[model samples]
Target: MEDKIMPTVEELKALAIEEIDKRKEEIIGHAKHILNNPEVGFTEFKTSKYVSEIFSKLGIEHDANLALTGLKGNIDCGGGEGPNVSVIGELDSLRIFEHPIHDLTTGAAHACGHHCQIGSMIGSIIGLIVPEVKNNLSGSIIPIAVPAEEFIDVEQRMLLREEGKIEFMGGKQEFIKLGVFDDVDMAMMCHTSATNTTFGVGGTSNAHIVKYVEFTGQAAHAGGSPHMGINALNAAMIALTGINANRETFLDTDTVRVHGILTRGGQAVSSIPSQVTLEWRVRSGSNEAVVANSKKVDRCFQAGAMAVGAKVSVTNIPGYMPRLDNPQLQELFLQNAGHLTTKDDIDIIDNSHNGGGSTDMGDLSQIMPTLHPYVGGGDGVGHSETYLIHDYEKAVIQPAKAMACVVIDLLSNNAAKAKEIKEKHNYNMTASQYLNFQRSVAEVIEYAPEG
Candidate 1:
């Protein structure tokens, strides 16, 4: 038998893009279906099933029910042995009760445009799965649908935690602990954004810590024995005040963000409030700043308990690390994006641009080469009711094409580019080190006033 000749990288990319365009309608339809039937993190049973069905129809092999309602599929290139690249899509939606498209029963809505991510990921798979494209590449592609990227529904997630269903609050963190990414060498995922009119590359996100707080006090009759009970609701309010008071101390460069919501206020109107719970978050530009701000927030909680003569318990949960974008991956994405859109429409952000948001992709970046970029077809603010994807092609298909092209660039030529990235990459920590650091952040503190 004669040796077969392979196509050039550009030719492979063109073929992939054509395949994606041919399947554009189906991809867009899938995204719309997800938008109309949104599910919250770790509970995306319907979404997971939907993705699994699609994978099955495509003859792709995958592991379902990962990290609770997440899924991962593998596509072997059949070229040779090399690094495995992961194409990721988050499978959860935010809880926005007021959104017009929100699920009335669960208040879940695709307000963050995660639906588009799934679409793009599938589109990328469609492009890369052509026999010609696959045969020319030297590595594999892992298409992953991850759960709970929004980090909402803390109370329910905590309940799941207590039940031993999950250990970490964020899906990607749990995926890490479960060794889901153990075989992968690099990863890429594009997020939808309304801040730009075109695709964006390069940018860092804040590091953060999660806190679950409870204030306990005595209950008494509201009308006759109000003074006999300590006011837990009042304690919570005072804690908010304390938190606000310390905001002035937050340095501007540190990008500190301290905020939370009161989940429980009182049991009934007739009795004084005895128990109150809050879900709090502290974020900053760096890990050190996050730790410092977290301590300050914890002290504020204790201060509220001391002032109101109530007992308080604070459970600190580990959150995302700051995002670390790979330079080589960023350049590849930029080059490919430029091919699809003009320079004026695209913004190449510096590595230092702090997005003031957090993602578990940051955690993955600490241990491996990863790319977290943004694509625009969205309008209004992200994670809000007003956010909507107006251009499906730009939001989904374009990103898919760009990623497909990048895959070709990295893996088509005997995967020499991927090998180079792996060798030159200086990761911040190993997976084991990351797990240890997160575990150290988990702690419980109890406080009561001394008589």
Candidate 2:
């Protein structure tokens, strides 16, 4: 009788690559479908459902929840292993993009290419489970569909938080509450961006940024009783000016940004507008600095509120998670990218110095060995109506393939690689530490708004 010998790692790797290549069209199609039906943030109903169908067809076990819109599957690369790795996909599409099919209801387009973000991750999962690849499995790869990376619509998110629907603002942050990463050793995510580089390696100094500041005072008749009512709108105006007053104090190294506008200054020209709302954002180069700067800005609001004797309540809507990454996983991505693209074409950015942008994945990075890399789609412009890719297939497909390769190589490969990544990152952050930090920032934070 012929022996049923297990497949070797080399054979499995080859098969995984082959499967990814062969199913390239299907994967891209899935991505484009998501692109065509762009959903914004947590409102990814169709996008999530469609991805769920795909997962169901694959016969993969999944968990659907209020937080995670798409599917999450567990693949035992190890018959029984050392560490489990998770490969995640962002399901919610950016609301703005340079597309013709615009949603009038939501006014959302897939501006940030999240449709493709989750799509590539999902496709890679399918490729990872090809018969040959599955046969050669050695570790675990958890495929997940995560929600609300964009963190837009602060008022709605605030409502969600208040209703106990979600404790944290970002999707990944909420997932962390459920101990999603308890068993996962490492994590990987790819961002579709505008740039032609080997590996877009940079971590965002993500901030626990604030969104809304409201000041309440008694409203008086416009022409009748201006002196009797405290002007809440005026307080917001003064707060705006106060922040701007200290703008010169902003250090060049810190990407300190403060911008705001008074939503409700007053009803009439003659009367005092008591209720005022200021929507603003403050950010810096890294997570810590952002929090520090926020406190300063929050104090400005407090001072202004006190100046007008208006009751003040500043609520921070859960904003994006700043990029906190594992350099180990990033190095692995860089190495695999070198193989995918020519060396001259790849530039491994030194983001150790950059912590300016914000992303929901930053929350995940704080958990496990996570790496979020950008891919060049066009010029430096993103989230703009004019933003576009020169070649949909070349720009997106190649990076999609690279992301898949990274997940497969690192997660489904030998136990040593995953172990090395997990140990190097030392994702020892406690749940309480993360939650404490979350509340600590938005409540007590003071700062100027970003322009």
Candidate 3:
């Protein structure tokens, strides 16, 4: 009797790509369906159910309704025990009413191409679930769908926090707190982009803090005795102006971004505004800068209250940290991507390049090896009504194939590559340290003017 031979690593990669191609239509359909029926963070009940149904159909075992609307599924390769790798997909959309495909009643829209994330995540799973592939591979695969990545609906999230439903506003932050990622040794996810490159890897994002500010004053009839009333709206305007005035103090190297929206002004035009509320954000390339700039912004709010004899209260919410990409993991992804497209089509973003955006994935990256690459398949500015996915193949199928190949390389041969990467990687913080630091960032400051 002759001994059986194992498939070469290249052969296994080809098999994975072939499997993804075979299920391309189903994968693309998932993205299209999600785009049409958009749901915003934490309130993604319908979208969650849809993803749950798809997971069930594929015979994937999962837990549902996590962090209000998150889902986590697991698949154990029949080969052996090793490391667990997670593929993440965000389950929330932005509240863009003007987007063409937005939900009519809720105005929820996938203007940021998160729908394609779900497609590609599932596409990778499809490629990896082939009987031969699973039998030959070691360890486990985790598919996680997280909610509320957009961090909008601040008041509603505060209510949830008060109710003890969630302590953190971002879905990934909540997941970290809940120990959902405890077992995962490494993780990766692909985002859709409108750039010229077919695939992009690397680049850092900003660390930020969310602010919910309230100004309180006395209300009086505007038409009759306007002098008797204090105007909260005026105070808010003064604070905004003060923030703008301090912009010159910020350094270009810090990439400081301070912006916000006024959620409420006055109830009626005939009366002075007694209460005004605002949702503001402070972002920078480093945590220290974010903290320093946040203090400056808070002082401006206090100044506004002093100028108008109104009381101001500011609630600071912990936002995302700057991204930290793993070079070894990036090289693996880049290598796999090169197999799918020409080298010219891929973009290797510098590690120091900060995009001035923020994401919770950065929080996860601080503790483990993580990859957040981008796939081009869309046109129009991100988070805008005009943003739309034009090429499903590029956005979903290609990344899926590349991710599947990378996983094959990591998990095959007793997961030697995964272990090597894990051994060599240096974590910036432990999970407990991250949680402690984020919790420390939460506080409320109030200012009242002396008469």
Poorest stretch of ten by lDDT in candidate 2: 442-451
Against the true structure, whose lDDT is highest?
Answer: 3
* Model 2 lDDT tens row, 291-318: 6677677777887877877767777654
Model 1 segments beyond 4 Å from truth?
1-3
Instruction: Give the winner by lDDT: 1 or 3.
Output: 3
Where is the poorest 10-residue window by lDDT in model 1? 194-203
Off by over 4 Å in 3: none
Each candidate: what lDDT?
0.92, 0.69, 0.93
Task: Give all TM-scores, in the order shown.
Answer: 0.98, 0.89, 0.99
Question: What clash count goes with each model?
Answer: 0, 28, 0
**Worst-scoring 10-residue span by lDDT in model 3:** 127-136
RMSD of 2: 3.9
